[model samples]
Target: MDLSMMIEAVVVLSSGLRLTLTLTILALATGFVISVPLAFVRAFARPALSLSVLAYTYVFRGTPMLVQLFLVYYGLGQIEAVRTSIFWVVLRDPFWCALLTFSLNSAAHTTEILCRGLQSVPKGMTEAAATLGLKRFQIARLVTFPIALRISLPAYGNEVVSMIKGSSLASTVTLLEVTGMARQMVSTTFAPYEIFIVAGAIYLLLTSVVVKAIRFLERHLATDGSRRQRRGSRLAPALPDAGVTTP
Candidate 1:
């Protein structure tokens, strides 16, 4: 292993870090926004609505992300209507094409993760809320969604990590992300082993940071729940003596 070559790879690869992070963050943010409503539709809406969401998720999840990227970046341009359309300007850009593909793919997986979280909410809790006269939307907003979000956090974190790694695929569309830079350098220097190892290390570091953040969030949520429970216990009214007789 050439030590200097490895160091150079790190520096070169670092140039692409911003693009890599940009793609990952934007894709995840957009996906989360899109998935939240879709998840609700999938989990709580009528069969017609739910099945539509299910089909969307199924197609994206069933296909390889690389194929999706190719379809968006290459296949779309093949259509005369697409080329003549107002959206052509945005679709023609490789960066936007990659981002669109990644966001849709992430949204599909996130919808399923959130749907499972929503379904896992205890029936009794929602029922109790209803018995207290809470409206459906209010119960979902105040009780169900919050709990479901916490339940979904760990799984969502895994998705975040996956997106970080998957962002490397953007290189296929000529986006100069980390892996793209690594490939460029390898072609010039004929040192794939060193460059790729550095790229792998960068991905590992990003994932490690995500995992640590997820664990911290889980612990914080647990602490908050315990505190709320203790506060509730303290605020409860004291019962009158059980053995006391009425005058």
Candidate 2:
């Protein structure tokens, strides 16, 4: 590739990086909002509610994000009422549609991750919270969520890394994000390997940042002491009548 092509590719990819980060942050932040409540619901709700969430998770997780993005963008365009309504203003933009799809997709995964964290909590804590006159919501808000979060940090970090990479799919819907710009550069410069390598490097950088952030959170939570006990404790299976006692 010529130096001019390299310069142009850098400029375009830099412009694209902003949209990529925007989509990543918007999806992750909003997905966390959806995930926290859904995690609680999955942990404490009846079988029907839990089953419904399981189904929702299956649909989002099992499908390719590319299909979901198309369904949100082009499928919504097919409705005459949607086209004529105020919602059309937002839906007409691929950016908004991609954001909606990514957010919903991440939410499903985070719900499952946080739900497992909640399950890891020893049963004693919930009963102790109840004896202290804590309401269900209060227990969840003050105690359960914080502990579950600390427990789930590693999994959630993986989700964030996945999210950064997933935002590249937004390019298929006409948003000129990093991967999109890379493809545009490739088409014009006939340097597919160069542009693809650059794009891959950018994704690697993003994933590394996510890993560091999760490590920071792990240290912060460990400062509370309970996390150490939780970490060190062996999760042995229940015994029928062996009379074994945990020290």
Candidate 3:
């Protein structure tokens, strides 16, 4: 590989980093907000309400994201009703379409992950909270949601990584994100190998940072007793003997 060409590839690809990060962050943030309520419904609501959530998750999760992107970006404009609707102003833009599609897709997966986490919370814990005179909403807010979020963190971390990778699909919709920039460079440089390597490395670096952050968060959120024990263990050797008198 030519050193100059490789350096050029890095700089060019870096230009698209903002767009990639924007898409990923917006999608994950929106999806998470939407999923929280849907997840609660799926976990505890009667089948009448839960069945709709189930159907939504199944449709989005079962289908290809790329196809969803195309449908939103290309297919939506084709319908006269869609074209004439007030929403068309936003739908006509590729960025909005990609964002909408990615957000919905992320919401689907997140709902299921959160639902599982909520379901996994021990029934005894909720019963204990109830017996203490906590209201249903209070128990859910003070006891249940926090535990479920902690339990879901690892799986949710994976979803974050997946969203970062999946944002590359935005390239298909005319968005010049990192992968799109690489493709554009390859067209001119005729060096797909080098250009794509840089792109993949960038993605790997992003995901690694996310993984480390998630691990740090996991440690930070550990139970107070566990955190204290771990801290004590680390500090034990540094302390002078408790019973030893100074010379």
Best by TM-score: 1
Q: Give the Cα-based TM-score of candidate 1 against the true structure.
A: 0.97
> Rank order by lDDT, top first?
1, 3, 2
Give residue 8's lDDT in candidate 2 (0 to 100).
Answer: 61
- Could you tell me the lDDT of residue 118 within candidate 1? 98
Better of 1 and 3 by lDDT: 1
Greater lDDT among 2 and 3 belongs to 3
Q: Which lDDT values do the candidates have, in the order given?
A: 0.97, 0.88, 0.96
lDDT of 1 by residue, 156-220 (tens): 99999999999999999888999999999999999999999999999999999999999999999
Please list the residue runs of candidate 3 whose C-alpha ends up more than 4 Å from where it truly belongs after superposition.
223-247
TM-score of 2: 0.86
User: 51-103 in candidate 3: lDDT tens per residue?
Assistant: 99999999999999999999999999999999999999999999999999999
Q: For candidate 2, lDDT tens digit of each residue in 1-247? A: 4556566666778888999999999999999999888888788899999889989988999999899999999999999999999999999988899999999999999999999999998788888999999998898888888878888988999999999999999989878899998988788878887677778878888889889988987887778677667666756555566686666
